[model samples]
Target: MKKILMGVLCLSTLLCGCTKNKDIQIDDKKVGQVKLKFDHIVGAKKLVLNDGTYSNNSNETFNINILKYFVSNIKFTKTNGEVFTIPKEESFFLINASQSESLQPTLNIPEGEYQTLEFNLGVDSLTNTLPVEKRAGVLDVATNGMYWDWNSGYIHFKIEGTSAASPNASKSYKYHIGFFGGYETRTVNNNRVIKIDLTKAGISKVQENLSSDIHLMVDIGKVFDGPNSMSIATTPMVMHSGPHSDIADNYATMFTHDHTHNFQKIANNEK
Candidate 1:
């Protein structure tokens, strides 16, 4: 009778421990949302569409009239080294400096402490070739001006402005960079993947009932001068067919993580 009672007690202790462990286990399947807030800036100054004049490293002052680009293929890395990628269909976003609504791209992802954020600076090649009907929302050609003909694909990045250094009679310059390795014929692929480490700036704590805002600064001046600095006076126009790899390389260095803000999702919804 003593041995039997001892065996029963052990079984009851093990059952209680199992129940306690299950109560404290984290649900990895829980999901949260994050908003990527992009602030357009000219070096140290905030960007003003048509009036603000900024100077690049090449010593050319210019006033921007238009600034737009595509950001897609967003992914987040957790503290445990797990990667959660947003669905491809909902990942494409067109960020236009002129539009306030397009500045922040919200993404729903698994709940965790994310240590890194990754995204493509331009639309991927596969999505670029999708049928016209399949491409909707920001990718819709009829609604957005970023699209070129079916043969040339979409224009990933476009900027237009006026500068005294420009040699044009009107002193205007335009840079439209895009070419996704071509559909049939091979071309220069300017699509670049940008990764931002969140540990130094601020790690994103994405949890249930909370929204994390990852603030990023995009310096427009970097477009003119990064790894390859170019003078506006020498080459004012960079279209689909030209040496634009330098421009692409320069713009790739434009994004920097500024900070992160965690807000109560319920409170935001209430307001």
Candidate 2:
């Protein structure tokens, strides 16, 4: 009887060991969510900048008529050489000021450390041709003025500022920047990416579930050197900001290195 009991106990122990090993094996191919947030550091909604710096001084503040842009193709890179891209179906994001209060927004990320991030500064050809009824977020027909009488496509960015530099206005420089059409020179197209390898390495140990909020600084001054290369004299009208789009492309210059950002952590209640 003792031998029989010992044999039964050993069999139970082996089964439990196998079950425990199976439980410890986590699926490494799980998919994670990628979030995006934006911040428009415009000095004031109604106010404007003289030398691209927001100020309370009357001489510095200029009235703005419109300011909008599109962000698309949000992507991520893992430290181990893996890449994740926004699904082709829902990749574009519109970063409009009228829709949101500020420019500094947070992005949602999965539960792993990312090696790099890539995003577009303006709308792409695929999104531009999308009909108003099909648009979402900043691309909504109600907000974005990209509609060219239902014939043309959406404008990538509509930034209008009024100032002395603006169309002979009393204001300093009222500027309006937007895409013209689906197949016109007025349309704007620009994309940018950054390597956050160092930053990713520093925070690799952090679980994505722990960090939910991330900060990305958007500096308009860096986008276009107001008083510098992009002077009011040269880029006064949409036609000017377009043909000279290369000059306007400096917005990337404003995109600097990464910094400490915030996000949600794994919930204590979560198993």
Candidate 3:
């Protein structure tokens, strides 16, 4: 029957149970839009994983219950250097602090002026050695907790709370930070580089169309600064050697920014 009616029109173009393939036609340019942002914080305020705790300092309480992860390959770099990745079979991203609207998540890109941007907070090694099918938001896996139930993959970074310096041994200092190979872990790549120099990002115009708000800030004590140390009732684990993953790559280099987070931007609304 026409190959089962062309396999139901190619599975209805992937969205009705999504095998993905809704709209993809890059290297052709003309669909410009990028309002990508995901800002959540703790130190200077704004971060609420309520119910399972994690309120922002009215007196301080913490309990992330169980957060999700993943921020796959996404690159954009122009200004003659020329680069625009974003195809790890469609760059994944699943951040869930129990979905506080998932903190300003946005995406769309076409126009170009980029200087540099790179991503991969997790899920590398070709989609963690690929078998694929855990889908929803952020590559699904039944709603993106970035896997790793016992000894799998995925779990780049996930901070929890309720400390007095956690040490009944390990009830949840669960810093499941990953990358169990060289060239990409340990003294290799705790990675960092959001150095998006949009003319030093004071922003004047880079072929603008509209929505361009970029405010990224995340300095939760620099992800436990060094040796991933920030305790409570106790949960300490930093298993990335080479001087503790180069002090977690110097605490993600204390994320450089201009304003704050918890509102997220890059929603270039275009003209």
Candidate 4:
């Protein structure tokens, strides 16, 4: 009878602990939302997917058919240097050029005055190590074809198009970049930072006037001629290629500051 009584007491203690944990989760503070818009363009004109012809710094002409990439580890830093990092598990995003909705979507953020926005241009190392079955959200390889099965890693960025320099009949060229271990990793840093002024958007405190949108531009011409220039005739494609650090690094820096708009000021939504 004593053993039965002890077992009942232990079970009650366990249930109590679980209830406390549940309450902690439910007590999380409410936050506001921010939007980020991406625009793809050439020197001074908007880019037309698969049809617009643009010349690179290297004087090579090309047209992009598909452009998809991943952005993760988004963090916002205030002028005072206080940083707010998005929850790692829920921060991964896959962006496709064909999808307008993907250009700018509202994302939840803690109430704060953010002056600088930063994010990774490719999948982070942690998500790169996980298998498809074990991943979730945008990192789920099953839903997104960003996974490379043969080499074992996510394709952080992909650019498929046709270049006049291509020797093939289709004049097709492709660049796929990622982390594949060993010397192939190429030691390239794919993180990008952008200066932002959220005051104009009326984002001053947690949940105060939270509707803010920032627009950014991605220049395709920069891809072939950033710090270095790429020739499609020499390197038209990279699927399983172990070393694509040059092209990856070039395209990673293509993002530039555009304009921000659609500022809707709502009262502090904090709970």
- Which one is best on lDDT? 1
Per-residue CA lDDT of model 1 for 132-156, tens digit only, reads 7898889988777887875558888
Query: Distance (Å) between predicted and true CA of 4, model 4?
Result: 96
Ranking by lDDT: 1, 4, 3, 2
By how many angstroms RMSD does model 2 differ from the true structure? Answer: 12.0
Over 4 Å off, model 2: 1-37, 42-65, 98-110, 131-133, 170-209, 226-228, 239-244, 262-271
Best by TM-score: 1
Model 4 bad stretches (over 4 Å): 1-30, 180-209, 265-271
Candidate 1 Cα outliers beyond 4 Å, as residue runs: 1-26, 266-271
Q: How do all models score by TM-score?
A: 0.87, 0.63, 0.29, 0.76
lDDT of each: 0.86, 0.50, 0.51, 0.70
Residue-wise C-alpha lDDT for candidate 2, range 1-271, written one tens digit per residue: 9999999999999998776221122234543333344544643332232234343223333344556665667777766767767674566665665666434333344455565667766666767666657777656766556544544555554555655544455544433333433464544444334334336323322233444334455556443443235545445555324443553465554443344333345445432
RMSD to truth, every model: 10.9, 12.0, 17.6, 17.9
True lDDT of residue 183, candidate 1: 80
Worst 10 residues of 2 by lDDT: 20-29
